[model samples]
Target: MIKVAGMLLLLDFQLLPPTASSEAAKLDSLFFFLVALCGTVATLIIIFILYFVVKYRRRTPDQLALSGRSYRTLELAWTLIPFAIFLFIFYWGAKLYFNLMTPPEDAIEINMVGRQWMWKVQHPEGQREINTLHVPLGRPVKLAIASQDVIHSFFVPAFRIHLDVVPGRYRTIWFKATETGTFHLFCSQYCGTQHSGMKGDVVVMEPEEYARWLNSGSEGSAASEGQKLFRQLSCNTCHTGDSTARAPFLGGLYGKQVNLQGGDTLLADDNYIRQSIVDPEARIVAGYKPIMPTFKGQVDEEQIMLLISFIRSLKEGREQIPPVSDPAGPQPSPVGDAIRQSETNANAGNQPRTNANSTDQE
Candidate 1:
């Protein structure tokens, strides 16, 4: 009994690393449960093996071995027991997996861009850091992760979370830190010669300290940078605030369902917004012509994130700045008026002339 107790104590020491997040605790509980179950089954199998070896050992060669007897009840018991245990494991694992994938709606959002050998973390307030993430303890954080070069994985052993960050698309993971400390962060995928060096730290601090740190380094919020990009990219020329503009007004578009040209509706989530920017022709919105140019190569991932932040901020009917016009020439009429007038002329059977000047104005 003493020996067995000592062995069990030593086994406890070999358990998983310290868990720092709520999800990590839950995951570790499931892991330990599986370990105990497997250990029990292995011990029973070993005991049975020893018993059969001794009981069947031949004492005399002439003493013909009793004809082997088969017990249907024993066979069925072994098979059914193992099968039921496997089913239980499957169901428990599936439930934990679903819980890990779903994030709370109120989670604080952060953007992460992984490159050849470094991680770029951007807070919603526009604070940027290299290879380090500062998050508040006891608050849920949702990471919108992407890779710039190749496939990378965001892994934190202490948090028991691992997610793939692929280029040209976004992946997300969330965790609520329960402890206040720094934990190891790693890119578990092999991308290049420097994959071994793709490691960082996640610093969890108190809410007040996190807020101060977020405001210290960055000059402006991400939404502000996005606003500048929106104008510089000439997006404002068509997506005007006026309802009669050629393109749909992007105000209040985030988190809302949008009708597509293919008679399908899609929720305007971050992924959908990203696809619309990089591949505009992929899913055209209903009632809108597929004339918008793609910004795939024109902007990088960080810039795209900034633009998304800006667009998401346009909630509750917030107005956007109008497109800038040249001061050296006569001002052109609003594009909305031109669209309405052209529609009226077409309805009245009049020859609707194309507004070349209006196009030049834009």
Candidate 2:
């Protein structure tokens, strides 16, 4: 509010939406440039049209009209000038796009699952929030998003980030916050009957505040959950320890070239690993039988993300998802530690943590 003389007046007036992230400001700059350029061109065209209307008007009723003519120089100028302008715009837009899409390697990964009319946000430390995301200010954050049912678009206007959340696959987006505040989150796509209700808030906090906020309600790391699921499904029976003779070793398998059954080697990427789990016969590993059963209906997309995180951590060893300690003292997750000691015990011929009811498969 601003006081003018003895009157109080509202000071909030703008032609653009609020921008809270670095990406938002950059995008706004481009958008503003486009609006200015187009407005200038349109204004000039209108003025010229009015000028010609008056200058070349039929002043006398008996005066003959000018014959239709064309100027090659004018034609070339119009064509080439617009063409050059378009090319420049394309290059600038493309560069901005690639920069936004390519996230820094050090960026922290955050997961989001869209279902019904709410967004389920999961932090790397395993804190889950419904329709709310808490991120540290000035730090790069990557979002791995997926949907449970229909398609939903994750739209954050203040951050200038909008992405589709499809049911069958995972899509990723990134942003680095420049302003610390709460921003609105919405589903731009018409998801369902309650699409309008699919809204959330992004809270950007200071580094110290964010660190303390993370320790509030964590369920444990996602990898720890994945590791527990591995034991529940008896995945460790054939993927590690004593089962390498029958199935391929899973440790350090991610991002590596693995020979297929037909003299072909396939990269164990996220897609390949996902297909291998849901549809085992899609690509069989060399010396391994096509006996692995499909787990499509058994595990959901969120579970698949957890499994992938677990797999990615496998290459870096069990310490990938270590216990997060706070100022109080060292606190360990019950399901944390990535089954290190349990696997060691199993290797020592002690009773393994495999479920007896589970059928063994590669």
Top-scoring candidate (TM-score): 1
Query: For model 2, how does the per-residue alpha-carbon lDDT over 1-362 read when each residue is reduced to its tens digit?
Result: 33553253355545566799888888888888999999999999999999999998988889888898989999999999999999988988898899788877657678899988999987655567899999988888889888989999999998999898888777888999999999899999999899999999999998677866766555555655666666566665566434444567766677789999889988887678888888889899888888787888999877877776666545423332222221222222221222222322222111133311111111
How big is the positional error of residue 272 in model 1, measured in Å on the Cα after superposition?
Answer: 1.1
Show the lowest summed lDDT stretch of 10 residues, model 1.
Answer: 348-357
The lowest-lDDT stretch of 10 consecutive residues in candidate 2 is 353-362
lDDT, candidates in the order shown: 0.77, 0.72
TM-score of 2: 0.80
Q: Tens-digit lDDT track for model 1 on 113-158?
A: 9999999998766678889999988888889999999999999998
Stretches of candidate 1 off by over 4 Å are 1-15, 54-66, 316-318, 325-362
lDDT of 1 at 306: 86
Please state the error at residue 354 of candidate 2 in Å. 26
